[model samples]
Target chain A: MPKLWNETIEEHRRAVRDTVLETTAELVAEQGLRGVTMSRIAERSGIGRATLYKYFPDVESIMAAWHERQIAGHLDELADLRGRSDTPGARLAAVLERYAFIQQQRHGHGAELSALLHRGGHAAHAEQHLRHFVRGLLAEGVQAGEVRDDVTPDELTGYCLHALAGAGELPSKAAVRRLVAVTLTGLRPQG
Target chain B: MPKLWNETIEEHRRAVRDTVLETTAELVAEQGLRGVTMSRIAERSGIGRATLYKYFPDVESIMAAWHERQIAGHLDELADLRGRSDTPGARLAAVLERYAFIQQQRHGHGAELSALLHRGGHAAHAEQHLRHFVRGLLAEGVQAGEVRDDVTPDELTGYCLHALAGAGELPSKAAVRRLVAVTLTGLRPQG
Candidate 1:
């Protein structure tokens, strides 16, 4: 095939895949994980069942793909925050605040979906990447004398992540910010 | 009936119920939650199946009763620590250390059982009591000027609980203690 023809075909396939994933997410959000079906996803995405099947084997595979995309997006957002031109403390605060909000937003996905998506290799891989990403930021903060050096950066990362996870149960964005503030205080140097 | 005979019958019933709860916990520890059954619990406790049924409808009720007892015991242990004659900071450290250890020990119970027992009224009530108990300690620390007063005791309690929950995933008791130390540091007055 000609190069232009090949490029057009690849772009079309990518667009179709994105549509299927987004449509499935909307369906799940509207009707719950149990209510979603492959046929419904196909109809909603405006793709034939045959084309949808070519992209995903079933509803579970589609949901997994969607979750993977969401995790990737979150990681990228945190990275962007880390890359901002500011004091290390300011960047760290921004990342922690955003992470807490993400944790709070995750509560809307429901426990059943969480249990399903939290299992398997993808979630574990994402967790490792997230830990490494946060640890790097903490190391930067420590070198700048903004974060405490008494604890290892790895342990501090664990502390921050576990502490902010409570944001999921918090009542509001302001409460999540308060939780983040308390967590940040824990990372400060001792007197 | 005579009062003496009535007292003896009540004592016997209490003994039977205690045996059933303990035996069910042992069974779950040895063979996972799904392996436990009403017959197995009755047999292990050396009680008739009919008598066991009179006490608990099935394995789930038995487990629920055991979890409730465990939660109550933990709260009492923390309360005892809080009541000890020491500085407020010392008492808070002791309670937090014990709480972290308890959270670590809970990891042995398996996720299935945790899910089952964490739902419904008992877990929520225990959580409320725990928050109140921890908040009281924080208030005492604040009064002594040992703990930070910038944040409310209620928020600090939430922070401490959520942070120490990571102890469940820590590799050792030493690590759990380290987690507790970090959390306590966060509670200290800022310079």
Candidate 2:
């Protein structure tokens, strides 16, 4: 893998990008979203501002890229849950356990994500990938009779997000799971 | 009513306070959180700046008052649901329906709310009240057997907010309702 010069060059670039994102992530998490900026990120990353700008045009792009990275990680972790033999209930619990850690990351690993979301950029790839991944999961649950067949996965995913956001209250992992249970069992239409 | 007015000047001040808040709410709803400042509010309400300042020292105060007023409304609406004979599932549906509207308020109502949440001081009231309203509801749901009884309402509410803000897929109310249903059901206990 290291023998190819182009591949080696690409690896170095990726390493630099990861370092910059990791530093920015920590700053955002520790200080909250408002403190993040290209200058600050570059300074923290130990790279010159010019060098950093070459990689990222602006602070928003940096945040956007960081968010995509985090989402990718989350998706990868949940990838196998779709095939798990557990009922939809168990599957959701397992997913929430994973998500809860991600959520807890707000004070650290999640800082950049939270900042980016608040900053408000809707990149197309991230949006489509998230929707498609969730849609696939709900479809699996329905086929298994572990989750209700009537409602679409998109709806389910949205509700989980808002409820987790605590539209009415803050949501815990347990709260998320219980809500899923009622949804899979209670909200399903009767024949 | 005329006779009552002579004895209830306090009520009149409260009424005026609400009108001032409504003015800010309307403007912010139309413009954005940035659009709301002492001067804009005073001019829009046709109340002098001094008078507006007399009621609310800054945008934060105005926001807190607005949120508190809304909290009063939410409590009133959900009061009957609390400990009522309705299934936890039904009660959660009721809550999400209300939240769908709350989110819509963001296109306008959210700017000021955002301003308030991000800042501290009198703005702290809004955040506190907002959190309180959410936790109170989760507590109710926990008792209803619709939400998992094991978790704290605060953790649930916090995670939900982070998730709602993170979910990049949702755009409309119909979508929000479906997502909310999925989330609420997920929170139900495993048994």
Candidate 3:
């Protein structure tokens, strides 16, 4: 192939990947990850099947790429929570609000990211991100003595998020804010 | 059909249902739920294609019935924390333990339920049952003054279970226990 033709192909491939990611997110959000088929995605994106497969080996890879994009976006939103305040309580509350806001997104992005992990095999990157997030939160709490020193940061943050995420009862913003409030007060060391 | 023959057929249906449940579960555990197919399930269970359909109209019905059985079993397990106790604190702790045990089983049962919820599409009943379970737990907690009376029982129990269910870290019994302990303590009413 000519050098110019090869360059065109690379640009086209990159475009296809972006389309696949966008289409996959929409389809998966609307129909869940199981509903996303390569043919369906290619058809929806107006791309050929061969081209789509050239970008993704299978549905799981498509979902995996989608997952990474999601994490990147969510982490960016969460970035503000980092260094929001010097104190543990201020940082904790800020992060909790961020977590709650992410959960409250309307397009079911949080739910789908979870379903993808549940549906597809566990991704090491996702797990590591969670561990990092939790470990960071608990480390701060422990150092400041705001949280129990006996417990690992992961254990504290892990279950706290576990509680927050699993809470289907907190259907609205008001409910979650209260949950975050309760969690913060409870986590403070007893006098 | 003769009455005697009808009785025999009914008995056989129960056996077929049990066989289908076991076969599907084994398939899920071995290859994950996505690997389960009608043809494979029947072949593994030594049942004919026609017979499998006769029992379950489609894969969803079979999965729904299996989930219904699991929900029934879980309800039976959680039936005691009601007015059976006067203090919400003790009762709430009991509810937490019950929930934690359920979390421990989630890797096994959770996978199947997750697959059904993710792929099966019979969401209404499953969600209703979840809401019902949490509402009942929170009502008991609130009435006993073990939980804050400000928030509705529905929200409290809903979030608590939601948190517990999401605690998939390590998927170990000890890990679930520790996570649940931290969460339940956080859920305790303020002094």
Task: Estimate every model's Cα lDDT from 0 to 1.
Answer: 0.90, 0.62, 0.70
Say which docking band candidate 2 falls in: acceptable
Q: Provide per-model DockQ scores.
A: 0.68, 0.32, 0.42
lDDT of 1 by residue, B1-191 (tens): 55798899999999998998898999999999988888888888998999888998988888888999999999999999888848989989999999999999998887788999987589899999999999999999999999998888988898999999988888888888888988887787866
Clashing pairs in 3: A162-B163, A163-B163, A166-B162, A166-B163, A167-B159, A167-B162
Angstrom error of the Cα, residue A132, model 2: value is 2.0
* A1-191 per-residue lDDT for model 1 (tens digits): 55798899999999998999999999999999999999999999998999899999999998999899999999999999888848888999999999999999998999999988887589999999999998988999999999999888998999999999988888889888878888998898765
Q: For model 2, how big is the CA root-mean-square deviation? A: 5.8
Candidate 1 lDDT (Cα, whole model)? Answer: 0.90
lDDT of 2 by residue, B139-177 (tens): 777887667765567765554444344233456666656
| Clash numbers, per candidate | 0, 34, 6
Tens-place lDDT digits, model 3, residues A1-191: 45798899889788888888888878977987667788999999998899788788987788777777776777766666677777876777787777766656632555545655545444556546766875787688888887876556766776667655643334677877877765565466644
Model 1 ranges off by over 4 Å: A1-3, A86-88, B1-3
Better of 2 and 3 by lDDT: 3
Lowest summed lDDT over 10 consecutive residues: which window, candidate 3 chain B?
Answer: B115-124
What TM-score, computed on C-alpha atoms, does each candidate reach? Answer: 0.91, 0.66, 0.71
Residue lDDT tens for model 3, B1-191: 45798789889889889999878877766876667789998999999998888788766666677767776677666666544655757666666677677756666655455656445444566657766866776687777777777666766666677667655544567777766666666666776
Interface RMSD of each: 1.1, 5.5, 2.1
